[model samples]
Target: MTVKDLRIELTSRVVMAQILPFGLLILILFGLAISPDLVVVGDARRPVIEEIAPGLFWLTVLLSALMALGRAFALEADDGNLDALRMAGLDPAGVFLGKALAVTVQLVAVETVLGFGAFVVFGAPVARPGLLAATVLLATVGITLAGTLYAALAAGLRVRDTLVPLLVLPVLAPVLLGATQASRDALFADPGVPGWSWAGLLAVFSLLYLGVGMLAFGPLLEES
Candidate 1:
């Protein structure tokens, strides 16, 4: 089931269209908006690009995740395949896992590109390689799971485009906060606390959403 979902999502042009170019656009926009300024001290000059790359990277992920999830289910709804799946006796939990897995894969790809953009465009260095990698993993999982769940909730709505963002962004606040802070700590030296702690919080968020989706998806699909 997961493999089928992966194949469908990987082959979708929409995924490629949104993942790289859109993310690069966001990175460039952020760079233009937040250009580093020169500050002089004791005849020495430095370019100060504040610790904002992390937040901007996460923001790109949030926006892209919304688009990916919307298009994924939109296709299912448009083709009437969602109902067909429900009647086809596949476990709703499996379906949810498949969708979540696909979204996670797309998001990870976007995040990788965004991470590189942050490095080259924003000058955010990898201060803690291991911690940074873990933060990326946990944060992506949390965002993807939460996005997938709300996407299902708004799957049948007429104005789902607007409704899904409303439902998703608010719930994603904790994820954005944790991911941004963790990324910042990982991209800079001596952040005062271990980034792994924030990764743990993100892990909790992912588990909570995963459990909810597994329990609610079956009933949600039936009612939708």
Candidate 2:
């Protein structure tokens, strides 16, 4: 079942959905590189990289995730194959993991690509490679774990677009704030303790969401 889910995600639709964010991030980064610095800077009146880059990186990541959510369940629904999977002996946890796996791949790919793009465009360097990687990974999990479940809940709803954001944003705000701030601190080497704290929060969110989603997915899908 895991292998089957892997196959579906590796195919074109989900892969493209994953990669589209790279393109969008590139465009945004390019715009920022060339734009007229409308976003003001911190004290000392200097246009600090730390002040602006994190928000730009995070918003791009969020938008890209939003774009992919709509496409996440379509592959299963369009072919009438999700019903078949339910009928099979696949465990509920297996099903959630499969879906989460696909979304996680998509999330990580988008983040990696955009991270590199941010590096190139903003020249944000990692002061501590290990910490930076850990922060990136935790941020990805926080996004993907919650995202997978909401994607499931809003799967067939006509108002999914509206509802998913409503469901995810309030839930995601803390993650976003923590992730953006932590990534900045870890990469730039300031307030490292707070950064680790945010990373810990992100980790907790990921594990909690993963366990809850794994436990609830079968029942959620049964509604469909």
Candidate 3:
């Protein structure tokens, strides 16, 4: 199931061509808004944008993920594929995992592009590669899990285009907060902040949503 969904995502022109460019454009717009001008600090100087780059990067990612979620389920809903999958007796949990994993892979690719854009456009440097990687992994998992669940819930709705974001974004506040803090610490090596602790929060968030999606997806699939 995972492989099938991933193949669809890889070959889909909308996912490959449109979604990625949208994410990059958001990053570029953020760079323009923040201005990469260095400001004086206690003993040195840092780009004003660097201070906020982590948040900006993650914001871009979240917006992009919303679009991806819409596209993923829209394809299924529009093509009557959801009903077909239900009739085929595929395990709902398996289907949920497959879709979530595929979305995660897509978001990872988007994040990679946005990461490079952040470095070049925001002048942010990575000071702790390990922490940054952990943050991205855990946050991405959490985002995809919760997003997949809500996307399914909203799949049958006429307002799903507007509803998914309204349903999913509020629930993802912790993820956005944790990812930003952890990424900032990773990029700046903030001595006062415990980036690992924020990463742990993200891990917990991912696990909690994973269980929820696994249990609830079956029912949601039936209703949708």
Among the numbered candidates, top TM-score falls to: 3
Full candidate order by TM-score, most accurate first? 3, 1, 2
State how far residue 85 of model 3 sits from its true place (Å).
Answer: 0.5
- The residue pairs in collision within model 3 are none
Q: Which ten residues in a row have the lowest lDDT in candidate 2?
A: 38-47
Between the candidate structures 1 and 2, which one is better when assessed by lDDT?
A: 1
TM-score of each: 0.90, 0.85, 0.92
Local accuracy of candidate 1 as per-residue lDDT tens digits, 51-130: 56678888888988888888777877887788788778888888888888887888788888777766767655577888
lDDT of 1 at 156: 57
Candidate 3 positional error at 183, Å: 0.3
Candidate 2: segments with Cα more than 4 A from true spot: 13-47
Error (Å) of candidate 3 at residue 38 is 7.0
RMSD of 2: 3.6
Better of 1 and 3 by TM-score: 3
How many clashes in candidate 2?
0
Q: What local lDDT score does residue 101 receive in model 3, on the 0 to 100 scale?
A: 88
